[model samples]
Target: MTPEALSGETLRLADAVAADLEGVERLGVAYSGGVDSATLLALAVRALGPERVVALLGVSPSLAARERTIAHRVADLIGAEVVEIRTHEGEREEYRRNDVDRCFYCKDELFTRIDDEVARELGLDAVAYGENADDAQRPDRPGAEAATQHRVLRPLARIGMVKPQVRDVARVLSLPVADKPAAPCLASRIPHGQEVTPEKLAQIEQLEAALIDAGFSDCRVRHHGDIARLELPADELPRAVAPGIREQLQRAGKDAGFRHVALDLGGMQSGAFTLQILNARGSL
Candidate 1:
């Protein structure tokens, strides 16, 4: 859509977000440095001044150092001050188990810490997270449950905004991460039922960073103990499997401690594994 058409169609969304923040002197935004949260941060700052907005990023083994660095840059671009707080989600046995409900425990801990500590110390009136309408269609998202339990605001979902609209709004606001690909937690690289450990998370991060350094921007390196399953866009899979490039791919995976490197020719898909589990359980 053209910028004008995009704005006209989504103007009500912005209005609803502003209305949601009404009566709140200050807002603490749960930021992950992704496009969704970055757009929310920009909107919060636009409706309220930079001084009224605080970007709260919960950091730990799950969050990548690259993402944290980019988050700081995005916050600076938005002129919103960011606070990086170390979260102990890894210490939670439920999270360490890496079950289907892993996200619930992880987010529960982060939101609990922010609500009990960050909000109290910062004198924030309300806490909000970036959950768009597209995310609402997914039954596997456990983070939303934590948000509901904490009574956190989901203005984007409330306003019926989806991923595309959020990106458009970010572009209109001149945010740097308008079109950035989704980057979920590093722990997500581990399949369900696998124990989540700092070492596994670090290996995943290292492998993903190596892939990006080698020119695969949007990809996922799923960890399966000694096996590394690489997921890239369908158009980019050839580059990973091509004659000489395949060797480089193996080196990258091996350097990250993977005994075998395999390619998922079906390509990179978000929530692919989660969808399978949800479908089998008749939950989706």
Candidate 2:
């Protein structure tokens, strides 16, 4: 679809979300600074004004430092009040178990803090999170289950807007994250049942930051104990093998404490590991 047409559709859907939130006296957005959440936060600010919208960002071992930094910047640009809450999902045994429902525990912790404390303290009448239509259709997203249990709102998904349409509207709204790629929690880099650790998450974050500094916009450094399996986009595969570039990445991986560095020929894919496990179980 044409950019203008896509943007138009996005606006219509965003308006639908705003209309859904019309009765709320104040709303707290479970913001992650991702395009999905950022777009929803912007819509809420437009609908209820900045004073009525609060961007509740959860800080945890799973959240990458770079993402946390950008989240604050995005909230500032959106003119929404930002609240940083430290979530202890890592300390939760169920979450650290790293099962398929790990996200469920993490999100449950986040929403509990939001509803039980943040919302009440801020006098928010409602709490909403960004779950795009595509995300709702996806099989690997267990976090949505927690959102459902908490009765948290999903404005974007309810309005029938997908990722592409969210980006279209974000571009029209001039959101900084308009083209920002999906960056799930650092814990996602570890394969299921590995037992998520702060060290592993930190290592993943360092390696990913190195790749980003090396000009990779979207990448993943899957933690496999002493080995780091790098996943870059198909188009960027050449760079991964290129002279000098390969050496620099080798050094970066080594610095991050990986004894061996290997690039996945399959290239970059969000939740590739989880999807593989889920598909194996026929959960999709």
Number of backbone-clashing residue pairs for each candidate, in the order shown: 0, 0
TM-scores of all candidate predictions against the true structure: 0.95, 0.95
In model 1, which regions exceed 4 Å deviation?
1-7
Backbone clash pairs in model 2 (N, Cα, C under 3 Å; residues 3+ apart or in different chains), count: 0
Per-model lDDT: 0.88, 0.90
Give the per-residue lDDT digits (tens) of candidate 1, residues 1-284.
Answer: 22244356456666677788888899999998898898888778877888999999999989988999999999998899999888999999999998888899998998999977788899898999999999977888998999999999988988889999999888877777888989999888888888999999999999899888888868899999899999998999889978888999899999999999999988988987677887888987
Model 1 whole-model lDDT (C-alpha atoms) = 0.88
Cα TM-score of candidate 2: 0.95
Candidate 2 C-alpha lDDT tens digits along 130-243 = 999999998999999999999999988887888888898888888989999888999999999999999999999999999999998789999999999999989999988899
Top of the candidates by lDDT: 2
Error of 1 at 65 (Å): 1.0
